[model samples]
Target: MKIILPVAGKGTRLRPHTHTRAKSLVQVAGKTVLEHIIERLKVLAADELIFITDENGQQIEAFMKRVFPDLNCSYIVQKDRLGPAHAVALADPRIAEGDDVLVVFNDTIFVTDLTRIPELCAEADGLIYSKEVEDYQRFGVNVIRNGIIVDMVEKPDTPVSRLAQVGLYYLKDANRFMQYLDQAIQAGDTVKGEFYLPAVFMRMVNDGLRFRAPEIDAWLDCGKPETLLETNRYLLEERHSCQGDLIDTVVIPPVFIADGVTVRGSIIGPYVSLATGTTVEASIVRDSIVNADCQVKDANLRFSILGNGVRLAGSPRRMNIGDDSLIEMDS
Candidate 1:
């Protein structure tokens, strides 16, 4: 099976960090979001990995080459920010007519066992991974009838079904998917002048294609700073361990500190991940993530996220700083 990862968004929600790097490259729990997704996909044994990227995707390309040097990968530049359906269509040339395709978005981190995907696809023409969500208005939901998805509603005002469609999808036939996409695009069937992937699925459903919605174990959103920190905490707690040695610092469980991290006279914990080469002295930090090469001294931080190479000193109360920033508070 071929896997297509669409990572071409500007990620406006992730601001300062996204300004410099792709959203997928944002670090959480000692690895990039893209790395987290790639690690999960490895179990599927994909034949080739296709990336649908934009102009600002150089970092993604570079990271993939550096990390998965031997993996079969291809890149397709989506020059227009048309929509998700359009983005998927860009990879049509690479996908064979009858090929089974796995499509995953890069904005959110999903944790689920995909071992049953082949079985699900064998019964239906397509498969969609869904999660039970209370806020159905904020997501595209699948309306299932008799164990099959009958319709897909994007952000329905009224409660239809709790099964919100996450970004993972599998199509049994790539050619049929492309045909539906072309019809949807030609008809100008867009919501707010942008074609959506759900629209394509809806079209397919109308044409008598069967799709199944399966539940996922975990779906973590990393679109903004707060959610990113929350996801970091969740992931760290799941695989918690102290990698580096600490001296004179109050070590708290459920924290991740990378190699070369120095902490002295500080209380770090409860949910904190410090990247490599970061030094903390005489500080108290909790529920935060400090990226690589940062120096935090004499500061009390909570619910904060410090980006790469950030420098903080002199009792800054709390911060949400970005990369390469230098801040010194008053004594």
Candidate 2:
């Protein structure tokens, strides 16, 4: 099956990091978010992979070429930042009539078996992955009836279900789905003049397109700053086992320390992730995330997220530090 990944959305929420790198390339637990998606798709034996990107297309294209050199990958630039539905429409040229296309959002990281999707597609015309999240109103919520999608409400004030779309979708009939995309865009019934994919899915429900829901094990949206840190912590504790390079430091298990980091005289983690070029000196950090080129000295921190180039010093007890910030702790 062919796969379409829409990575074009400029990550406005995830600034600084997204400013320098593609949102999909944001690293968590020492692996880029896109890397995790590509790995999972590869396991499913995805035949052709196409990326729809915006301004950061060149960077993503270069990165994908180097990483997945053997895969049949192609790139399409979306000139206008329309919306999700329009982004999928950009891939219409490459999609064939009978091809089954899995449209996955680039920002979502799924650490589960996507291989089961083919089987799910065999039974359903379209399949969407949803998870019971605390904030359902922030996501597109689907109302399913007898394994068929009956209605899709996008960020309704009162959500009917806690099941939120996890940004991964499977379409059995590529051409027909693309036609719905066309209808949604041409109708101009869009949110903020940007055509949304869920609207078409709702139209599909009325047209008997049959959408099924599959509950995924885990899904992380790395778009928000706080969620990025949370995802880092979760991914570190779940996937990464070892922290590279250490000296005179007591590290509890389930910590991720990136390369080129120098730690001396520190007690790190029940859950901690230190990015590259970070230095921790004579301090104790637990359940904290420190980004690259940051310096932590003589501090006791817990449950904090520190961004890149943060200078933390003195006897500071607890705080959340932003990037390129200097926090003079209480000595």
Candidate 3:
């Protein structure tokens, strides 16, 4: 199967960081979100990985080349910020007829038994990975009937089903899927002036396409600053284990300190992630994510996110500073 990664969104929710890098490049637990997705895809031994990117995605291409040099990959430029379905359609020419496509969105970090993909694909025309969410009104949810996905409703006032559709999908028939996309676009079937992937699935379901909504173990969102930091903490505690060099510092558990990080006379963690080359001096940090080459001196930080090369000092306070920033706060 081929993999399609739609990373063309401007990541407006994760500004500042997204201004310089793609949303998928945002680091969590010492690795970019894209890297985390790629690591999972590698297990499938996909034939080719197709990336749908936009103008601000040069860094994504460069990072891919630098990191996964040997992986079979291709890129397609989505000139217009149309929608998820539109972005997927941009790769139509590259997709072979009757090919099974696995589409994964960049903003969400998901964990599941991927080995069941083949089995799930065999039983349905398409498979959508969903998670049970309490706020079903805030998401597009799958309406399942007799264990088959009958419809998908976007933020309905009345609860249809709690199976909120996450950003993972497997289509057994790529050609048919593209045909549906074309029909939707031609018919001007749009919401808020953008074509949505879920609408296409709804159309397909009405036309007798069988879709199965499978439950995933975890669906961690990294769309905003707060959620990204929360995801960082969860991933560090659950997925990775690291030890940083602490000099006269009080270290907390469930923290990830990449190599080259130096903490002196500081108290760090219970959920902090410090990237390589970061130096923390006489500070207290917890529940934060500090990127590479950043310096935090005498600052007490909590629930903060500092981008790369940020130099933060002065009277110890929480901050959400971006990359290459220099700030001084008064106590």
Q: lDDT of all predictions, in order shown?
A: 0.88, 0.81, 0.88
RMSD of each: 1.2, 2.7, 1.2
TM-score for predicted model 3 compared with the true structure? 0.97
Over 1-331, each residue of candidate 2 has an lDDT whose tens digit, in order, gives 7899999876878775666668887666666789878888887677789899877888888888899888998899999878888988999899876788899897778766777776776767889888878888788888877776788888878858778898898988889998889988888868987888788888888877788888898887787767876787777767655555778999886788877888898898877878889999999988777778999999888867676788989876556555688888577
List model 1 lDDT by residue over 1-331, tens digit each: 8999999998988878887788899888888899999999999888899999998668878999999887799999999778999898888888886688999998889989888898877879989999999999999999999889998888899998889988999998988888888888899878788889988888889889999998999999999999998899889878676777587889786888898899988999888889999999999999888889999998998888888999999876567787999998887
- The alpha-carbon deviation from the true structure for residue 182 of candidate 1, after best TM-score superposition, in angstroms, is 1.9
How many clashing pairs per prediction, in order?
Answer: 0, 0, 0
lDDT of 1 at 316: 62
**Winner by lDDT between candidate 2 and candidate 1:** 1
Off by over 4 Å in 1: none
- Residue 152 displacement in candidate 3 (angstroms): 1.1
Off by over 4 Å in 2: 157-159, 292-331
